[model samples]
Target: MNWETLIDEESLALLLPAEYSHFALPIKESLAVFLSRLPQSVQDRLVEEQLALPVDATLSERLGRLAHSCPVLQKLGQILARDQRIAQELRSELAKLESMPSTVPLHSIESILMQELGPLESKSIELLPPAIAEASVAVIIPFREKNKPQQPEGVFKILKPGIVQRLQLELDILTEVGSHLDSRLHDLGIPPLDYQDTFNQVRDKLRCELRLDEEQLHLARAARFFADQIDIAIPELFEHCTPRVTAMERLFGEKVTDHNFTLTTEKQNLAELVARAMIVQPILCKDEQALFHCDPHAGNLFSTNDGRLGILDWSLAGFLGAREREALVQVMLAAICLRPEKIATTLLSLDIRGQCDQALLKECVAIWLRRMREGHMPGLSWLTGLLDEAVKTARLSLSSDLLMFRKSLLTLLGVLSEIGANGFDLDQIVMCEFLRITVMEWPGRWLSSPNSRSFATRLSNLDIAETVLSSPLIAGRYWQAMWQDSIERYAVCANSR
Candidate 1:
């Protein structure tokens, strides 16, 4: 759309409250700059198309509808929902993009199945009518093997034909917009390549969703990763699954939003189970290289009939390198202690964009830590808000992995809030898990290190009193107490089980 038509002066005023209205000029100029980047023909076409549409609708409403029509906008909406810098009402409006997307006709789905599975095999699986769920990229339909009437049926996920092509077009538009913002909005304090890198990452993730074979493997691997754990369950895939049509055991469960556990204990159990499964495992298993779910929102999680937390949608997953995992530990520790300098330092190091205004970054972090310490209850929104401001003030750019992590963490926190377990403290939960993980890894590390024996001999020769008075000794004692407390709690849970 042309810059003038898209700006919607009234909407702009509402979006940037009166206090920030001074920014309206710059924002409009930025939009104009973006429009100028498009080919004249394309720009004229878009402007004509937008002019033909109804102008009476509010800007937020118009954007919401646009998001529903475009995958790129839907992705942007997901990010907006977690960003505290945006107005809450606007954020909530943007969130509608993620609501049930337009579904494909049944005939279209059947055609896709027939093409992917061949006519004979397609007929072998009795494809049920209508779709169970529809998202921007794909629709899920339940099906059963014709020969195995007694066996349970599974769901087949079929990608909407031509979605990739449509998404590519939208992505191209977004890239142009990003490029213009990068070039024109120098005073906005964003690094030159920030938008380019972010859009590239989004493109990569969208491409990943096109690979159903890879997603199926991720499901199997995740199931294997948590095999020994009794509280988790992953959908079982049928042998006949293919890249375009994946058949997976249908979960007989309700999404967290739909399922009301009601009882306090049940809510607590579900919360703890999710905490261990999502946070603890990923943070602690640096050596094993944990497979982390990038989307753990309420819709993607279910409370199964068998009382286990059923995980769904493994298409978007991230692996934490050892260094990233260690940084996570340090970041959480800093957060728990309300150490702003440490928090700012660890976070800045994670940024891909080189240097930034360190003083400003630390100042922003300190304000957030103070609020959180005083009972504001830090969460995805708070963290993102702080980070967003810091990045704006410092012109720092975050890595793609870190951005995904932010989204995932926000999603996990959203689920936790919905469960409403009283006395839930994410910081404490992370601290306890961090201690347990450290304790579990320490012995193995000591045993494997060749210098351990020599170090122990040298330590034994030191004065016992002096050693006990040392900082390391005090820290060890504190961790030991935490470990013992964790063990006792686990024992209690086991006994209750």
Candidate 2:
């Protein structure tokens, strides 16, 4: 249906805030640096987009629209199967089920679903089931819809237990979430990606508490969505994701995140290694920017016998950009260095609230920054205090990614603190290592050193040069024209209006 073209026009109104676009000081040169790498086709597409979009939009607004309007995400697995290996393995497993007795239960479950959800919105149970309940196994069952019997996803899967019932309930809710978000965005005339964090949280809670296989399966898919793809489809797919019930079977591996068992000096290195790996992860996995591994938690990450890190649980992920990732590292680095103002600035830059008590925010920033700076995980005083304040004051909803970022950070820090990371300095050699890597690919100019007066001076010069160059060619023509002075202009324009 050439959905990309269909959506591009309407998406601008939501993405470009009216207040931001009308600013005379355009950020073109900065944008040009980014645009140079794009293909001619994409550039042409973007040019049309930029022309239609308001000139004074914020970077976030512009980037947000671009993210959701892109088409590739909508058509995942359509071109060639990116995960052919995983798909093939799944198919083989299903085949093996046909020859085993375990196939009976899955067949029963599929039968249970077909009668419930209808033929559409369901994966085909055409494949057989698993023979044994391996530690972590995912099962797909088919069914009919309670309302409409004819949808594509009536079929579903499980990652834990309580599959069939929970998903039906949750799917409807997510659909509503998507619908309401869709309506609000449509009103703004912007084609935007709906936030999936809450929806995925519900999905994760359902999986972890219920221990359903399909829930975990969906989580894995969510992870895959963030980890490997940057298409708009991730949100849409997640919006319509049907879990019904999922069980995430425990996979066997050397447990990661194990902080306590008074380790021998020999094993201390392994513990340190796992701990170090946690920090290095965001740095090492730049190539997979396409995916968002939202949960790099100890429980979710494991080390194999061969020392390869195994990351599981991908149920919630968004297509995060490089700038966001870089900002994260920088914020942490600043925290370690006890740079309170820098940390406050970075946090606010992440869109905490456009205008709040800057001093208060700095105080809060300093508190947390101090903890991370000292490599200590502070108590709930640092976290719940703000969260409690925001909730009490108003329903302050920040980016859910920011929420996840906080959760992961807290979890990591809390673990390190509990385990006695005596010399685990946040501003240690690792900071320099990450700093070099970050500088190597810092996406935005915002990350440069604060004390670099020379760079600042050059930027000031460039701004002046660009402003002079961009002087309107419309020059004295429009400048000299009186407002509605021409009789023909007034009469003709009035008539058209």
Name the top lDDT candidate: 1
- How close is every model to the real structure, measured as TM-score? 0.74, 0.38
**Global lDDT of each candidate:** 0.67, 0.40
**lDDT digits (tens) for residues 63-140 of candidate 1:** 565555556556656545434454666766765544364378888988988787877364577777668777667788
Candidate 2 error regions (>4 Å):
1-164, 167-254, 257-266, 276-278, 283-292, 296-299, 329-343, 352-359, 365-397, 412-432, 435-497
Clashes of 2: 67
lDDT score of residue 289 within candidate 2 = 45
Extract clashing residue pairs from model 1.
none
The C-alpha stretches of model 1 lying farther than 4 A from their native spots are 1-59, 79-102, 120-123, 186-193, 331-392, 439-497
**Cand. 2 TM to true fold:** 0.38
